[model samples]
Target: MAASTQRRGRRIMMAPEELDTFLREARTCRVATVSADGTPHVGALWFVWDGTSLWLYSITRSKRWAQLRRDPRISVVVDDGEDYGELRGVELSGTVEFVGEAPRTGEPCPELDVPERLFPAKNFGLDDMPHDGRHAWMRLTPTAIASWDFRKLGGL
Candidate 1:
């Protein structure tokens, strides 16, 4: 007797509620990009979910920002907060066009005195600071996104 197998195309769309859960589940993402000299760089970042977009902060002096300065295109990987079971993930591929130090997104950039201002008071302290020239803040706007939650798949 032969056994049948099931294979189906999985769409990468996360429902509004699912997205909220995923975003809340994962607060960190790794930003990846290539430098002007063709060097690869990746940095872990804390992000905020605005329902329609993802926001994060970076110091202009950071290597990640240097690479992004030359290449606006980048990738971000955010994973589920759980340990072994039910791992969900969100992968974002988009351009990192610089909008200057303006607050166009109404999202606060990382600063020495204050965090994104979105998190609770206990989320950050006055220890964070830009290393080099003190860039103050940065913003990354997402153009494309891919996310998956395996809750329905028994943790695929």
Candidate 2:
């Protein structure tokens, strides 16, 4: 699908590359899902932006997982900055698919270690994460996305 864009003064819209960078640099994203009864569930998750899609490692037993099993649609938001002038973010909506096996609680598993490998290197400058197990990967291929950078408004 084509990238979504909204006009804001004279600044150019955030291109696809810019959106990838934004998702990569941000440490955490808020994932939103809906329950069978239509109640909204939102939670913070550590994610990896692998150029084409968002990969999330989650505990299989979590409520979010249960909700996603019933409904695969999800919305994710990743953003940063303390003040309004510095605010910037990306919002993505898509359907997610479960990938690979879920590491059972107290079991040893290596496939679900993207966080162990990528999170530390990208966020903490470390070689590896010091933990493991009880998690699974969820892949979201965004169908629609929107992003904004307050810095783009400086010229106005």
List per-prediction Cα lDDT, in the order shown.
0.58, 0.77
For residues 67-146, write the lDDT of model 2, one tens digit per residue: 99899999999988777767778888889988766653423446446545676688678886543567777888888787
The C-alpha TM-scores of every prediction are 0.66, 0.80
Return the TM-score for candidate 2, rounded to 2 decimals.
Answer: 0.80
Instruction: Quote the lDDT for 79 in model 2.
Output: 88
Give the alpha carbon lDDT tens digit for every residue of 3-107 in model 1: 112123154345557866776556688888897777778889876555545566666667877777677788888886464446667677777555436323333
Instruction: Give the local distance difference test score of model 2.
Output: 0.77
RMSD of each candidate? 8.7, 3.5
- Over 4 Å off in model 2, which ranges? 1-12, 104-117, 123-131
